[model samples]
Target: MRIFGKFLMGLMLVLAVACSRTPERGGYRPAPGPGANPQLGDSAPHSWDGRGPYGQQVHGIDVSRWQGDIDWDRVRGAGISFAFIKATEGADHYDPSFQRYWRETAAARIPRGAYHYFYFCRSGAEQAAWFIRQVPREIGSLPPVIDLEWTNSQTCPYRPPAQDIKRQASIFMDIVGRYYGQRPIIYTTVDFYRDNRLGDMQAEFWLRSVANHPSVPYPGQRWAFWQYTGTGIVPGIRGDTDLNAFAGTRADWVRWLQARLTR
Candidate 1:
């Protein structure tokens, strides 16, 4: 939610100077979505190397404004337990439909949460400020998440050095904490953790580990969610869509979800 360019120039300089000594805590790397793995094309069928046909438990999708013409009923029919919808973006950019869908899902009674794409180029406080403006004040929903990963898009291109990336993430998390009022989950990869020492943060992590089932690359560490694949097929959803299986069970889903009453 932090806007880019708001405080990036100053923070960029700070991260550049202080990144060599950050320590490694522990973490997870989510694999790919059920749709298109940036590494793989859209032609790849939605599937995973782990559990046969993925887990029969809680399932869901995280969509950006890009995925169009969605049939959410099919998604509901497919037994999706929850969905983390893309809401606010760095300081300025927001999906046009973020509010619309936020209300839509609220009406549909889908288990949902909002996410902010982290910008390593900015300070955490600024990013958090941007996110707070976007997210409505409400309670009992899924915890806010800080989506931190390597993204080289045009609007916010101009990558920082790798160590600086870690510093930026540290600041981003600090900022997100200020507003969200919870230690938000960090979504990132193994290499990012290793390179940036993200393990040091030890915040609740949503890992992208693309292997069979949920296995920790770094032993003796606990991870919150493991993203198994970008390609996934679920019953009721049209064609094949990307899917993610949580590390726990249906009961876990019920526990984590915001307590909302729906008829």
Candidate 2:
């Protein structure tokens, strides 16, 4: 009986050791890629002095799992005209909360779009296929977005030359555009804008300029959406959220969506 008891204890110890060695899934880890501002995109909320200059324009927000579970109804009530939700990143990772958020936003009557974080480490074609696989090509949805930014992590340390980066971006946009039947928007930062000379691309631009208007930083450049502040306070979002404004008025917003949907 003593020998049997000893064998049972040994079996339990081995099981415990095996469990300890298994890797658990990570929760809420933001992707290392373009279109997120590391300084402003942290998990915690940020403080802002006042709503920035684009208050008069049609406003919106962009979000991912990092924002935690969101109340989409409250967000719509906050006078948010639109939203861009993170759908996929790289070649394999899909945002864990994407399906829930997508359904909730649709039910809440807020126009929502899907965006893929472009990874410098992978081919743009592969990343686009990954995004296409995850995000359904739904009618009446806002156009897709390609977010490009420098990765601060060791996972993707190489910043290809300007031409190579542009080439990859073009390939990604082309494939995604073909699948969605609408041109994609390019979300980029000031430094990345200049580094890649993105003005040369045919895709509409979504520029991130927290301190100044995009026009100031991107002189003589036209932009479809300007992300004016990352520390925006909206009713539905628990923490500080990134805020954006369309370049045109409410009528323009309707017209824009109609054109995309019917085109």
Candidate 3:
């Protein structure tokens, strides 16, 4: 019995060593396991006013050609920690401002990412390929975002069935994920989320809620970013811009970025 107990202890030690040696990405630390959702504390008030309920939350903005030329230096100085610059749209319509925004934002020392506006009219593989071609693979950048939501444009108003939508989304994300070494984030609206049941997908979510908190629409789901308002007024930006909040504190945001780097 004593010999058997000693053998069990030795086996456990071997397993412990194996677990401790888990690989990391380029020596970066990994994220905490599930239930490690950002320490965002309690839910805050839901309002359409400019002021956010969470005090001193890490706020950022997403911009494209509509925002005209951006002074990224002034933006960074205004306390913006990050930005999601538009990269591509559909399979062929690359956002004209993508390259300039990407270059200027990085030069300003802002941790930025690129997002592709998905179109139902084009094949997922084609869209993914186009995005990959346009956005350069930069180290230490945020994971590429796949913005999937309904559009009212007359050009392509068709919404594919839920299954087809899911399949195409999966294809696009898989392609981008394999290329970037990190899972892509899905940005969707409330109606789209409900129609497609996107919460089941095994990827991070960037939900859009203009009035209510995300919890009202995306209950019991994990989200990394939230687009709380579309009429946000930022200093360097001329017109209204889409503003987003990282789901955690400043420390949590740093850890989240580190986790993506490790991924």
Q: For candidate 2, write residues 133-199 as lDDT tens digits.
A: 9998876678899998887857878989989999998999999999889989999999999888888
TM-score, per-candidate, Cα-based: 0.70, 0.79, 0.79
Quantify all predictions' global Cα lDDT against the true fold. 0.57, 0.74, 0.74
For model 1, the run of ten residues with the poorest summed lDDT: 20-29
Of the candidates numbered 1 and 2, which has the greater lDDT value? 2
Candidate order (lDDT) = 3, 2, 1
- CA RMSD per model (angstroms): 14.4, 17.8, 12.4
Looking at candidate 2, the ten consecutive residues that score lowest on lDDT are: 22-31
Residues 113-209 of candidate 1 have per-residue lDDT tens digits of 6788877556666777887788774443466778877677776776677667666666766766655556577777766656666677758777776
lDDT of 2 at 201: 89
TM-score of 1: 0.70
**Per-prediction backbone clash count:** 29, 2, 0
lDDT of 3 by residue, 27-61 (tens): 11223331111221113324434334344346678
